[model samples]
Target: MAISSAGYEGTVDEPQWSDLLANGGGRQYAVADAASWKVTAGTADREVRIAVGRGYGYGVRDVSDTVVSLTLPAPSSGSRYDLIVAHRDWQANVTTFTRIAGSSARSIPTRVQTPGTIDDQPIALVRVTAGQTQVTEIVDLRVVNGSLAFDELVLQYLNRLGTKVRIGVTEWDRDVDSVGNPVWNRTDVTPDTGWVEATRNGGWAFQYCQFRRVGAVIFYRIAAERTQGWGAGDNLAIIPAGFAPDVATYVASSSSRGQGREFVFQTNGSVDTAIASSGATNVTLIGSYVAPR
Candidate 1:
């Protein structure tokens, strides 16, 4: 029978042909059967649904019975399918099918068709080999150029058994040393002590400190304000615990005035001695210390 709509020209079953002319409707037919129909002329758009059975619906052939081969429509830019169902027997073991207009066809399973493992959770894409498909949870996934923004980050280094090293930023204060010599002692500034310690020479204001350890090498940055002034042979600051310099050497050019005004990490203890400079000014000490683990 001939199917005729307002502008459709095609052949269909007598029942469908009559319905098309009487109600100006579209039709759904099996893909295999649609191959025989042709649209000669039609200005009005009509939809002809094509069904390719793959055991998902009632009475459809079981996906394991025969592999189903389908030629998918050319993909559009930025288009993605949330679900794709297929068979493994009809054509071969191949399941899903995808094709872009200008790219090679991809047969791998690229989407989830139903809720898997966890209730109502969709499974990610997976590769299926021969035989019936089996579902498994995806453990690891990687994305290129992906960014994760976080308010804070905690980094921990662990040994074979447990955590070994932990690094983080903490507030410290400058306190008077036990020897009564004006020394910068790293103290917990919880009560907001202002981190400033007034010594006989000048006042040392502790700004902040960053500490990190890589293997046996420890790196530190200590920033402080030098008020009043300092003279030669003054122990300005003390290295934090677990970070005493291994050798007795001076960090030259550590001051704005340069060379002669330097700092030395005493080999005997964690004390940092500042070689007398011309005047007292704000200073930042940044250096690496070799400490045994």
Candidate 2:
């Protein structure tokens, strides 16, 4: 067999079973990773397979009956990648997978650890692709015993790398007589109408959060107040003004000044208010970490 050193950059939307049948080849590579294909109506057309280069081997750390752990060395720092662990049983699903350095999971289609009955299934590990000086992401995925059978594991690297973004925030209580809904016309800040801006990044990400829908919804907790707008014996209930015409529950009346307070929405409560708004009022929000919601 001749050797070529080019990269494949096309999208692969085929099922694993069909690819396996078409290629019928898996013994020439130095590294290997399993790929799970979906089956529908007995036709396995599209497949999702892992492209592992030669000479790469599993860097296994330790393994238990239902749990296996390993160390993943990245090509560069700040790169996004994913590690998929396949279980034999569909019932045996991923229980939990936490990054060592507090990188929270952005989204998950299925539970990390779920029970399955399918044999030779594959899970995925996806992280943003980037170049950095230090490795900031380490993760562990554990499956529940007796939930599913065991199979091969797959690691997939995502295209986008995780870029660092800094943020800051400030909280204040406003009179709920009216003017609670901020406008969404553009990125420019509006007067009196709530608006937000990115402190950096050439105004890359900016979002404004507002409380709209009434009915058992907590807008925000007033931690401090320079003006007695939210001080002792204040009757301000954080009433929902603009979009929220209905009356909502507001936790007011703190015993002392500079005390700890929090707002929570009850279970099954409605938050029919927009977290953002715009108008012709001028207000300056002094804070950092202005992210787009």
Candidate 3:
């Protein structure tokens, strides 16, 4: 027999996957099956929408003859978030994944929370039925507050499970924090040894005020060479990661590496660099803003 996220994967016949949505006066949603859900062509359960409010529900789009689509609601900004998706049937879990290649089958429920919630959480769980083109889709999506208030947004399809589909939120990098924020730049070079302290001299730009990893060892140095003609450390040494030191926030200024002289840093993982001072020449104090690789 065939199977879908709406059903179970193995001999149990049926599986039940659900979520306990904490609607901060909004709706909630979760994708049970993801394999059969297709977005490109020749599929079903193609899209999704998650709703948040006093009552939580989801909207699914049936695409092609085999694809199904759905959507869920976004949680309130700056609020605690928790979501879980699991297989409905326990017995079928094994048979559900037996035939799928490059797939992992497990009875363990997949739990997701803000990054800090758990220690090394797997992105999502997968299961496939034997001898079937089983696919799964899970989605996690959020729409920032706009003029017109809406409860939900559509998420891009992720992967497939048994005969159904799965979708989840796509991870992204975004600019945050106001300029003029003081920060210290530190590559993995020397933890507290090298330091580059800088502030928003002015300019609207996405500065990488933090880094987490950089290869085996990140090499960074905070340098301020005293210009020969300029007296008493006249020329600035390094411009912080995201600042155009010599320009106003709204005005176009010289590049961060102007005149072929600037501070250099390397990072890969979580690192923090802040705007230290409005104007300070010569001395470049560097420190570990965030952990380095």
Candidate 4:
């Protein structure tokens, strides 16, 4: 008797089990026939054995009252496969599975069952890492339609060395002396005043200056006016704290009556102006510096 490509078929009276046995493609024997197989299949236990010419094969057995195990033949170095197991008990709390490859055995997390859940699930094993884990890119920014928005994003590190640094944008007005200390007599002007020590001498009035900082660098733009007319005299402006110039020799550009002069930073963090021509009402200064932390 032979089993054809279409498979075996027979009536009850005719029978096909003998035909399957006679063909000898595979065989079923008592479990006791395999001396190395340690499983109790009871008195009626039988096992199907097949000769795999290549690749691998699996043997599953109910080992004991509380244990079931699946065995696989040893595989070659580059070979890989996926294995799946199902549990009929939905209330089981098993959250891990064991894998034995070559001489190495490891316990891996089972994905199907999570804590506080009672459901049978499927698990996927991605990759086994043996060294450092790395990622090339995490995010990309783009505009959708005509709008762009993000719920949360971190632009800077929280800590530098052991100190905390912050970044911000602000707009304010204040009056100060040569070292950047605020003078309480200043008023907030309509168009935004950036002056330090603004004062009036008889008919002439002057607005000191203003400065802004980014990181540890500071940039300043200041202006003063001779309300009635320009005059010849020295005016002083204080540099704010945290933005003082590194040296007194630092020079800033000062212009009056269409002519440019130089203002210098004094050792006390003040800027001393050059003589202003009589009737000259506009005096301005501009400069930048790297401030100390």
Candidate 5:
């Protein structure tokens, strides 16, 4: 509980400086979980498109890659799950991604990363059928989360937005109206769910933002000017704990042209969406999610 600034004058004794990443690769206290390193199906079935991405691994600002193609090994005599992962290896002093070949079984194995600096960001799962050269099923496993030095994003929401939230008088599990109307069976939760107006990476100025949570339902309408680092598929706001959905919650929001834009709320409180153009930095987020407790 000492009062000290983060990396003042690029000093090593100060707290890990997350805000000064570009300045001689400042320290990264949190493993960045953003979409900078996105992986998708490449031009060929055996190839994967790895977009240039940036990440922080083990107190060091890791890699940011340009789009490249990675060809995986051919399938063997038995079906197995080959995971495509992006990680920074401190032992080799390199930040890159590779294919981890699972055993001839079904279970997904853990990463064999260096224990000292293990930053494994799973990109996708390539299921290989026995005796096949080209892949058929490429499951997108990249989670559109973000980085936080010492959970600064968490502290921002806690210190700035902790107030009396609106609570539902009587939350419910089952609701029925007419004799033969639709009956709803919902999970039970109280005021334990809430959301904060959050942004990506570091600094971002907000405007006209409001968020609320009642029981298992959370609503948010926020807009912010992007003034700091941003990555593809990063979350804008993080939903509080105890209300994470079993699956990702999707909400279709109206675009400026009245078109629909999809937003996903993940189990780790990451509110995700498609990558916006670099020129379009002013972002407006509005949606609601019903948590499946």
Candidate 6:
């Protein structure tokens, strides 16, 4: 085997199954943190389902969901068991669902004490009462994917839910790149894109107006007054590179002493303001909007 000095795949330094998985109460990632690739109740009583998700299970990336009806042997008086995983393992080339039996009390059941193969990735707990026909309850034991050493949100490993959640985000735009593959857009250091002042237009005077970019969002502050007639599409400022939103974003303000004004972010990176024809003075807005990449 070639020794990989750069932690690349197809070598000894390839990412492990635990790399994309997180723990429920385990601290491999953090102290008493979260779980990854979570499982939930299915349509049927005996069936539990895991939404289509992705993870490295055998040092290989696997994308799948679990919808199989688990075996339910009649409990003598009821047995308490922890569902160790969706852990893709065993010589049979299957995801082994090991039930570690323990206390029968109706509460958060105990998980495996020293689970590791890179530590145990538990999905949930299962308790079946004697003569029960279905799984009593499925406690949500999953948390943000923290199998890695960094924070999940900071690392951007999310997207482990929904149908075909391999690299797709339903609510987030620009998640997929030009080739449609999911990508992490953050850098090790967030650039300090400074703000720029807005230019006066159509007799409108700028008191304070500027915008800055931090990560994938753009924040701006505005304060201005109308000294003269301000038109509908007057440009205020130019949005910095990579900070303009896919769609136009807006901020509005109006005062009885001044006039109603709206700050519109144009796709061309120009910030425009539309003053109300029948309203009064000073407009001020302080907010942030997404700059999707």
Q: How many clashing pairs per prediction, in order?
A: 6, 59, 101, 13, 6, 8
Each model's lDDT comes to 0.33, 0.25, 0.24, 0.32, 0.51, 0.48
Please give, for residues 26-100, the per-residue lDDT of candidate 5 as tens digits: 322222344555566676747777666444433444444457677877664666677776665555545566788
**Candidate 1 TM-score, true structure as reference:** 0.29
In Å, residue 98's CA in model 5 sits off its true spot by 1.0
Question: What is the TM-score (0 to 1) of candidate 4?
Answer: 0.28
TM-score of 5: 0.39
Q: Which candidate is the best by TM-score?
A: 5
Q: Whole-model lDDT for model 6 versus the true structure? A: 0.48
Number of the top-ranking candidate, with lDDT as the measure: 5
Instruction: Please give the ranking of all candidate structures by lDDT, highest first, separated by commas.
Output: 5, 6, 1, 4, 2, 3
Higher-ranked by TM-score: 4 or 5: 5
Candidate 1 clash pair list: 66-89, 66-90, 67-89, 67-90, 67-91, 232-276
Expressed as tens digits, the lDDT of each residue in 215-268 for candidate 1 is 456566655656655565666565545555667767653456333456676765
Worst 10 residues of 2 by lDDT: 55-64
Local accuracy of candidate 4 as per-residue lDDT tens digits, 1-293: 11011111223122333332333223111111122122221212121112111110011111112322333333333332322222212244222222223222222233233312432211111122232122111121111111111111111111112221111221122245588664323121223224333222334344546666664456677666655543333545666654566665545345645245555665566666555545555656676765543
Task: Rank candidates by TM-score, best first.
Answer: 5, 6, 1, 4, 3, 2
Which RMSD does model 2 reach against the true structure?
Answer: 21.3
Per-candidate TM-scores read 0.29, 0.20, 0.23, 0.28, 0.39, 0.35
Q: What range of 10 consecutive residues in model 5 has the weakest lDDT sum? A: 158-167
Candidate 2 lDDT over residue span 9-124, tens digit each? 23323453333323323211111212111111111211122222211101111111222233333444445444434332324322222222112343332423322233222233
Candidate 4: which stretches are off by over 4 Å?
1-204, 227-233, 249-258, 274-281
